[model samples]
Target: MAYKKETMESDCIKAILDNNLMFQEDIFSFVGFARSTYFDRSLDKSDAIKKALNDNRIKTKHTLKKKWEKSDNPTLQIALYKLICDDHEFNRLAGVKNDITSGGEPFDIEVFIVNGKNKTKKKD
Candidate 1:
């Protein structure tokens, strides 16, 4: 069957957009479509689903932004800020990459033959 945009928007797509936590699987289950349909000959329908999902995400973000703007609660404000912004200090820390090199400090790792057998020694 061909992709029915109106029916999907009125039903499954509507439900998916209404729930922020609904994943692709949830949408497929709600729409009574198999997950495999997206990979087979129904790829176009899958693309439509993705576009609708993106639209819903934008709508959801806008709604959240409006609600966050109207609130006077400091904790709520912090939560929203944390959701949208990253800590500068943490970002700097995350960007620091530790390169493994033999240039920092000198250490003696040598094996010396003592008597007849080999012995490991460390420089003091």
Candidate 2:
């Protein structure tokens, strides 16, 4: 009763999307697989997801289509920015703006992801 790669991946994706937005490792565990296989499969999936995200960013920034819009509230805008900036691509592009030192301004966090995608701020 072995599952195929497509079945494994689809189950992994569903477990991820179905849960409370767990990490890659968490997703792998959910599907009862080892870390190695998860990492091997994740590399390609991560790349594809990131490429799609980049495309969305381009569309959001360059067109009047306005597929996505930030809230007008400074508080909400900053929160949304922090959420988007959590992505590695966004963090690097923004100089890791989300990282807070001991003596920096404080802000509220809304959504969080885990693993390399962890979005929670570490208390320094």
Each candidate's clash count: 0, 0
Q: What are the clashing pairs of model 1?
A: none
For residues 1-124, what per-residue lDDT tens digits would candidate 2 score against the true structure? 4446666666665665556333454555567766676666554366533454455556545452232344456655554565565467566656755666446666666975555665689999
Candidate 2 off by > 4 Å: 1-3, 42-124
Per-residue lDDT tens digits for candidate 1, residues 14-71, read 6566665335666665665555654454443555566767787788788887788689
Instruction: Estimate the lDDT of model 1.
Output: 0.62
The RMSD of every model to the true structure, in order and in angstroms, is 11.4, 15.8
Instruction: Give the number of the best model, judged by TM-score.
Output: 1
Question: What are the Cα lDDT values of the candidates?
Answer: 0.62, 0.55
Candidate 1 TM-score over all chains jointly: 0.46
Taking all chains together, each candidate's TM-score versus the true structure is 0.46, 0.33
